[model samples]
Every structure is written in C-alpha cells, then in structure tokens.
Target: MTASANLWTHTNTEAVDARPLDADASADLVIIGGGFTGCAAALEAARSGASVVLLEAQSVAHGGSGRNVGLVNAGLWLPPEEVVAIMGEAAGPLLIEALGRGPETVFALIRDHGIACEAVQNGTLHLAHAPSGFRDLEERYRQGNRFGAPLQLLDRAETARRTGSERFHGALLDPRAGTVQPRAYCTGLARAAAGLGAAIHEQSPVTRVARSNGAWQVEANGHRVRARRLLVATNAYHAGAEGAYRPQYVAVSYCQFATAPLTAAQRAMVLPGGEGCWDTALVMSSIRTDAAGRLIVGGMGNSEGAAGAIHAGWARRKLKALYPALADLPFEHHWRGRIAMTRDHIPKVVEFAPEAYAVFGYSGRGICPGTVLGTAAARALLGAGAEALPLPVLPAYAERFTTLLGGYYEFGAALSHAAAPRLPV
Candidate 1:
C-alpha cells in the first residue's frame, strides 16, 4: 500500500478561506467545531436570518466528518425495536422517524447547494458475516418492516451477486441510504452557510466560554465572541474549554484503507451496482467504492496508533479474502477517525445551560444525525422551542467508565483483526 494522505481530503473541492477570529465579534449564535454538525447548524441558523459565527480548531472538516466512510445511512446501528426498547416508545420512535428521513435531508442539501461530493444514492447493504449474523439481519429486517421501512432481505445468491463476494450468507438492503465524499459535504455546508452571511473562522480554537451578562462570551484565537446562544458540536474531537461542560462519551476508533483506482474490468466485477456495504461481524468491517473506482475497506481500529501495523496487515489479508483477483492492489490512502459512543448507542442533545446545548455521541452514525440534529439545534437556539428538535433535550447525559471502555474497544479490535485472517469464512 502506498499509504498517502486521506483520500477525502485530497479529493475535496469545496474550498473555503475562512480566517482565524482575530478581533472582538458578536453574533446571535456561536458554534464550536466545524464538522458536519457545526457546519450544518451554521447553514441553518444563517439561512434563518440569525447572525452566526462558527469556530474551528483546525480547518473545516478536520475531524470525524472528514474521515468518515461516507455512508449516509438512514438510522442507527441498533435495529428499530432495540432503539424503541432502550429509548422507550415515545422518544424512540420520534428519533427513528426523524433519522429515517436523514438521507433525504442530506441528499437534498447536496442537490440544492450544488455540492460536488460525488453523491450516490443507490442504497446500502448489511451483509451477513456468519449464520448468526444472518439471523440478526432477519430480526433487523422484521423490525425495520414493522417500522414501515422499505427494506429487502436478499438471499445468499443475491447477496453474492450484489457484493461480488460469496462470503456472505445473506444481506439486508436499505434503499434509502447512500454515500458521499464526506469531507466535501461538510465543506459544502460551510460554504453554503458562509454565502448566507455566517462567519466561519478556522484554526480558532475556543479556549474559554462563560455566560456573562445573559450572553455567551467565547475566547478563541485572542478574540472575544459574544453571542446570545452557544452550540458545541465538537462530538469526539472536543477540546477542553474553561467553564464549558465537556461532552462525555466513549471514544471508539475506526479506520479505512483505500486502494488505487481499480481497472475498468475490476470495477465492473466488484460492487458494480455502486452500493456501500458492511458486514455483521462483532468487530464490524465495511466495503465500498468511491466515484473514482477506489475500493475502500474499513474496520474498527486506530490505524495511526501502536496497533497500526496489525491493522494494515489485516487489511491486506482481508482484501485477499474478499477478492483474490485484486489481492495485489496497493492501498493509496489509510486513515482513522474517532467515534463518540454512548451507553445506549443513541445520539444525545444535552442542554448544558439555558439556550446552550452540547450535541454529540452519534455512535458511528454521524452524517445524517449530525445534519438533522444540527439543523434542529439551530431552530431551537433561534427560538423555535423544543418541538423543533428531533430528540427531547435532556438536562444531562453521562457515561461511566469512558476511559476503560475506550481501552477495551481498542484492545478488542486489535485482537480481532489479528485473528480475523485465521478464521473460516
């Protein structure tokens, strides 16, 4: 593998030259973080005529939003019934319904804003990695159908034909989902928001935040930003801000390795229908093709850490296992991103202060939930009230043993990847 820079960063075209916040400024709303959620919120708030300012520690899409697998899935990793079970009938169904239209919200933004993110709304496949995994898909199919989702259960033969791999037993297909160049989408949102009069500052990390004189005073890059409301959309990449409450969640790492552009024959033979796919294994893995015909495969592990070599070795083995014909292809890009995982595997919108909220914990489903929740946060911050939000605003949300759990996840992923090659298909 060549192991160059991130494919998304290299391919992103929605360039925005937002300078650092260097002087005193004021806005109706101040947003921290410049990933999907922050950019989406800035766009919504600005379009709604609210004076908005967004600050980013790095450049736009510098966090998880830029490093994602680009799968714009419809809902959470949990099945519909499981969500209902954990969040209850009332709150659960509300989130489920809202996120079910997440793809629509995402694709609509792409279309309306003329984003060149290589959007493909064909669909996604949840492949069964084992017989038990197939059973899980069956239950998911049943739950999805009960919730009025137009899902299809494909048998082994159909799954093989669709994925170009005979390893899976079956698959659950969700037609409402799709993929995009994630970083481009995030930058596009920021571009659209800035065009609508929102002030965006990059490399201006917030250092302190305090409620003073019934407004938020945010210090960043030697500049003071006073706003009536504040929204912290940092998720897993949140840096400590004095007097600002940090979001609590377990941090899980996910990595991706992208091959060089495949030959036309290879592309035609693999994932020809252009559907994103992920298997149902415990240490979950994903496979998809980008617009440039590069095969991107991902798994749960930090690719830039101590276990990086193990993960890279496993990627080569995995590619050989999946497609023997393309075993020798080089991976031109390899990168990793962190995921904010909540205890119940649900995203949280915590009302940390009056008119100030901290939204995070997408649990691996960032693109859709980030867009939806960010838009809703903007509406609420602009006086739309709680009804405008998807999930109810919780007074507080906490997770115990975050550090220990994060360690456990990384250890488990490393062990699984080390053993994955020796396991039977």
Candidate 2:
C-alpha cells in the first residue's frame, strides 16, 4: 500500500497549508526538508526574529516524521554508559544530557503551541523479550540510575500486568518518555512557525544548492532562494540536490500494522495506562495503543518489499503470541518508513560548506533528537557558535557499502520473520 494508507494521515488533527515557491525570495536562513528537523529549525529561527524560508519536497512530515511509531523516547537507543564510552567523557555527556531532556522539550512545545496531537505523557516501557534481554535491561537500569534518570525496573508480574502479556521477562520504564501522534506534532510545528513569520512552501523540491557571493542559493521549482545560512535537515527522505553533499547512512525499513479500535473490555485489559512499548529482541518490535484504542504493532522489515507477505504474516503471529484473545483482530491499516542508521548509530552534523550544515542519521530515534538538534543547528548557524550544538560539526562524513549493508538488514529481517514468532508466553 502507498503512504496514503498510513493511519496518521487519516487520524491527524493538526493541519498546515502552503503553496509552492512562485517567486524569487531571500531570507536570513533557508532550510530544506519539512520533517521534524526542518520544521523545528524553522520554528526556532523564526521565533528568534530571523527571516526563515523552509522548502519541502513534499508536504510537512511526509516522511519518517509522519510514519513514526510516535514514541517520544528519551536519549539514544544506546545506554548512558555505552554513549559515554563511544562519545568519550566530554562529548558523550553533553549529547546524553541534551537528549535525556528531549521528551521534556517535545511535551513543552505541544503544550505551549496547543497542538491537537494525541499527546500522552504516561511514560513508555522497554520490554525484555527473554532472560538475556532482562539481563541487559538490568545493566541499563544501573547506568540510567547513575545518570540520575528516573527509571523503574518492573518484575515479570508487573510487566505482564502492564503490557497484558506474559511474553516479557521484565521491563524498564522511563517516566520522562511517552507517545504522540507524530504527524500532527510536525504539522503543528510548521503552523506555529508560519504564524511566527517563517515562509514555508510545500512541493518545492530543491534541485540544486550553490554558494555564490558568500551566500547559499537554493534552486527549487523554477525559483531561487538566497540566504546567508542554510540547513539540510532531511534525514531519511532526502531528495534532489544535484551537486551538494548528501547524508550517507544505511536505510533500514520499519513497518507497522494497526487493528481497529478495540471494545472497552479489550482496552481495559491491554495497556490501561496507555504507555508505548518496544521489545529487546535483536529484530526489534514495538507496541502501543492510540487514543481511540487501536493497537499498533510494528517490527523491522519492509512491508512493501517482495517479501511483504512474510512480514505481514509475522505481524499476525506476533499479535497472537502476545494476546491470544485478540488473535482474530484484523489489521485496519498498514504502512512503512525508512530509518537512516549511521555506522556508530550516532547522529551527525556535517558543515559541508561555508555556512551550510547537513544533519541526518538518527538511526531509529527521530522525534526528540530531531527537535533538539534542529533547534541547536539553527542557533549555531545564526551565530550562537559550535558551542551551542550537542555534537561537533564535522567537515564531511561518508559510509562505504551502505547499499550492501541496507540489503543485509532487510534480508536478515525477512529471514527471521519467515522462520517463527517464537512465542515467549
């Protein structure tokens, strides 16, 4: 199915309207791509009194921003100790502390802007798919507490009560995180930015980016936008910049299937507190309930690929394994999105030219990091200096064998999905 089949498109409450670029324009800042990163940057820059022009190849949140599982998770997928070990002492804690507060930033924006997205702050659950998974969570719990994070380690009984399943050995709950209707949040950001005087144009795909006379000139749909600063905030949906540098990373596909709203009796037994969840299996899977009580189940694999049937079968089996009572539920919606994963699984900021930065590679975490990083990139580009950014801006970054690695991921996921559901219950 096409992206039009996405649940978010049909259920989203927030709306934004913009025309394609019709005439030549100049601004203090020009941003490309209209996902969480681009819209958040535009909002921040415009609020700071800068003339910002945001150009989108498609509509706002048309990419992963719209198709995300809507978990406003805190920090990266890696634990605090792993992050510190990989990023070193100084840079590690900076990024960790910044992202640790990512959920707060997201919730604050939703409240301050009165965004109509189904914003839920009841927290999220990281389930242990097996005994080994629970061991990993124990270490994560220790490191998280060391960093002063408010984390709770729930026993198997508690996990079963919370998730309405006995499949997990235990769970780690992060009180700071929750879920939102991602697409609505992105649209609301663009609307809020436009209200603050940021010029946003949809269907204005940038064809070329060139530096002329100490300014960046962006060509899009027969019009030119000249700006003193530029930000390429296209993470996974990057398109059409002929000569400019492109963000490089392996593209991993994730698909989700949602059932029709359950009856009140069914809802009462499953995630009564409305917390989003994901398991610790190597081939990760996610679960959550929307405000209307539809159960969404997602996993790693392309639902639009040649093995699409295999992935769909896995979803059905997965639901049955988790909740036998709901085994007969039919999926009402299904969709997929791509994730840009770096070699180190860390987000990168590449200062490709004099006053331009390309930010991408959020791995599987986008919503919060995109907002935090996009806002910081705008400040730095507006003369806040590199000190404002959470990570150092590199001159350039490249990854070899991206296509091969991406194919490997898809093949592994398909092979695993086709084999078995491996019911832990």
For model 2, residues 299-406, the per-residue Cα lDDT tens digits are: 999999988999999999999999999999989999999999999989999999888999999999999999999999999999997888998889999999999999
**Candidate lDDT values, in order:** 0.93, 0.92
Q: In candidate 2, what residue range of length 10 has the lowest lDDT sum?
A: 416-425
Per-residue CA lDDT of model 1 for 283-353, tens digit only, reads 99999999999999999999888899999989999999989999999999999999999999999999989
Query: Which residue segments of model 1 deviate by more than 4 Å?
Result: 2-4
Which candidate should be chosen as best, given lDDT against the real structure? 1
Which pairs in model 2 have colliding backbones?
none
Q: What TM-score would you give candidate 1 relative to the actual structure?
A: 0.99
**Root-mean-square deviation per candidate:** 0.9, 1.2
237 in model 2: Cα distance from truth in Å? Answer: 1.0
Per-residue error (Å), model 2, residue 218: 0.4
RMSD of 1: 0.9
Residue 386 of model 2, lDDT score = 80
* CA displacement after TM-score superposition, residue 209 of candidate 2 (Å): 0.7
